[model samples]
Target: MVFSLFSFEKIQKQNTTNIPVSVIICAKNEAENIKENLPLVLEQNYPQFEVVLINDASSDDTLEVFESFSEKNKTIKIVDVKNNEAFWGNKKYALTLGIKAASHEHLLFTDADCKPKSSLWIQKMSQHFSSQKSLILGYGAYKKKKNSFLNLLIRFETFLTALQYFSYAKAGSPYMGVGRNLAYTKTLFYEANGFIEHMKVRSGDDDLFVNQVGSKKNISASVYPQSFTVSEPETTFKNWINQKRRHISTAKYYKKSHQYALGLFFTVNVLFYILAILLLSILFQWMYVLGIIGIKYVIQTIVYYNAAKKLKEKDTIYALPILEVSLILSQLVIVFSNMISKPTHWK
Candidate 1:
């Protein structure tokens, strides 16, 4: 086993690592957020990086806002589209332009509305980029203290989302990622034809892209706190619902294999619980439902609670129950809306 041991050590040392990264933000009419969060981007403590913002023809002062910062900071470059580039109106089109302008080989993406929660966000993320995988997943959370039950619900949704991808990537089956805090190499983008197939859709530039690059070995995640992308949660339920519905519109295009995996997981678990509850009176069988919920939720939370502590949001656990309940309910609504009409535009 001496030779075998030497080869194993060689393979272990070959794990993914840090490389220069260009964080790309696509903005449209985000003057307020651009001003508030851009400094956070410019102030990252990392040694080597650049910030490229694609001003997707915002009607607001977004271009002027970024112009001031770009003047002082050489790393920040703003690409302005005349609001007439696509004329069809899609965020992915703006993102594609941003990718072309990026100076580095690795692209880290977030929205103008998002701010990195930690200075080490880049370092934590870059550690996961390797030749084995072209993509790395990062977490994005709702901004702090944004609401009551609604805010908690939003955070919980984010938490469980973190759990699903982070855990599943470790276990081998990768699903999707939140665009607000994700990274991939420039080479990977071009190799995948860089979102050309899904360009027409308003959403899924992130999800669809991940679907295309899905692989248990190649896909990876950084669940640590410093790498998390934190942004304002939707202030109103109507607004949040609208944003979610737009996101739901992209689900129709997910790969059939990914769709089957998700459907089986969710349908099987949900159906078992519903059946147990129906037989609760005669069999007390629903007691088993509580056990399954407790175990899965706890194990999931424990993993993420460690992540939250790292990210400095230990208090997020308080929102857990509300988030889970709302997630189950809202998904049904999203599924129904998906059937009616394909949603477009962000309200």
Candidate 2:
């Protein structure tokens, strides 16, 4: 787990060639967000790129916002998606429509609520793409709140997720990528059949698709600080848990190997804490147990410190122990809750 930190290094060779890119955004009832963030996206510092906006059957004024933006910006193209009886509430269907409408082969994806951390977001992400590499994974972070514990939890989870996925991508078996700052090729999407296998499974448009199509040779991990997208974190724990339920529910569908790998890693961490507690209470080799635990924390803290610096979540390193324990307990609740009932809404 610690060795994966090496993968966080910036890409050494950037693709300088002007790659005409298509930025695909699928939004539902995001008029307010669009009004604030779309302008920054349109003003990106790139040679040639078009923003493809998909207003997915929003009841609000999302379509009006897209049209308003299109009128002023010639580079903006809109794809208004009607609700499909068969694929209702499924984001993949809306995203597929947006992908089809994209004018360029190189596709970059972000949510309507997200904005690039830097104008070079597209350049940094797209630079990793080449003839062999079809998929590019970039970090998507949440906005921090000064005194919000929920905000800390959200950002820590996002940081840890990026660390694992980036490491796995660097190792060759890429299991997932976040949608807020992911890129791929149009031909690659078509070749993979464009989410046809999991259209009904609402939340895996980004991670699940990458899990199906990602390979060691065809994928690249982009970690430059400029290659990030930031979005407002869920303000309430209830809303965040609901969102997490939808996201975590998709893991059961990953390939068997990935399922085993992720499951084993999580199991080992949980058992380590459980066994340590039991041993310390019984006074069974307590000294050795403490020594080993101390060593583990030292190493983990060092690695997390470096990773936090690279990922720009440095505040999280201070409360790593508390955050890890809280995250694990909450995830256990979510997993059991999901087993009892699946998340209803995808958005």
Candidate 3:
């Protein structure tokens, strides 16, 4: 709980006059997303940066969209990966190619389905890089829509995930980061062997790599509103559940220390709710159950409210109780699903 009070003060913007950065995007069948979102990244208010767009064997108009953008924008560099039998459906491989093709040492990564919150996104995220720091983790949020409970749940879960990782990072046990908004040096990527350890797994290009190389001193975090990226949420429950399962599959590869810490937290959380229900139903200790749950809720609301304000998440604090319970149940489902299944693709 003390970690919840971790400071989120924004880092002072560096003089990026000559510090060039390569923004990398790995896309497959993201034609509409690229048309809609790539412009926001291309129009960032930064000094010198190039966007390295990787077309990873898309069967759509994705290549045409990239070609159109490349023709008009000199900063856009297109890398086409077509019919590569070895690195067919792996995002890490595409990212490796993009990193190799990048002209700058500093590299920023984001999904094609994401859009920056502001033109200062590049400035805010890149300002954290220094000689000592090699990793910068930024907040990636889901766009809020009207009358959508699934959207709310997705956003709430994302907020809670961010809360845990950011708190852990600030507490000197940095573990994971979302690919939608993350940055690191090319040297750090190669030094850590460029996700070779977890490349066999489908979905670890961002979090697992960070878990391997990130340290308290070497990693920085940016939660400024201007640095945030917004991604579209899964509209259907089945799609969202599949996405959660795919993400959970990567957790087993995290370091043992992180696994233990996260496991303890999950165990306590599930037990807290289970015990509360049991006490109320059998023991008939309604007062005690209510009191305990009330205390926990109050503390969580306080911490989450502050974090949400920093991350610019609005209207979610009111749904904390429902969201927390739903998240616990969803975690149980995801863990169970992962136990009986193996993920084969990186989609």
Best by TM-score: 2
User: Across residues 17-107, which tens digit of lDDT does each residue of candidate 2 receive?
Assistant: 6699999999999999999999999989999999999999999999999999999999999999999899888889999999999999999
lDDT leaderboard ranking: 2, 3, 1
Which of the two, 2 or 3, has more lDDT? 2
Model 2 clash pairs?
A: none
Error (Å) of candidate 3 at residue 51 is 0.6
Clashes of each: 2, 0, 0
Report the C-alpha lDDT of model 1 over 201-277, residue by residue, as the tens digit: 76788888887776877887776667788888888887888788877677678878667766776686567556656
- The residue pairs that clash in candidate 1, if any, are 143-231, 225-311
Candidate No. with top lDDT: 2
Question: What would you estimate as the lDDT of candidate 2?
Answer: 0.89
* Per-residue lDDT of model 3, residues 1-347, tens digit only: 64564534344446543479999999999999999999999999988999999999899999999999999999999999875677668888888888999999999999999999999999888888889888999999999998998888999889888988888888888999999999999999889889798877768899999899989899888887898999999999878988988888888899999999899989998888888888899866688879888998888787788788887775787898898889888888888877888644564
Lowest lDDT sum, 10 consecutive residues, model 1, at 2-11
Error of 2 at 278 (Å): 0.8
As a whole number from 0 to 100, the lDDT of residue 333 in candidate 3 is 84
Task: Give the TM-score comparing model 1 with the true structure, all chains together.
Answer: 0.85
> Which pairs, if any, clash in model 3?
none
Q: Over 4 Å off in model 1, which ranges?
A: 1-18, 85-87, 281-323
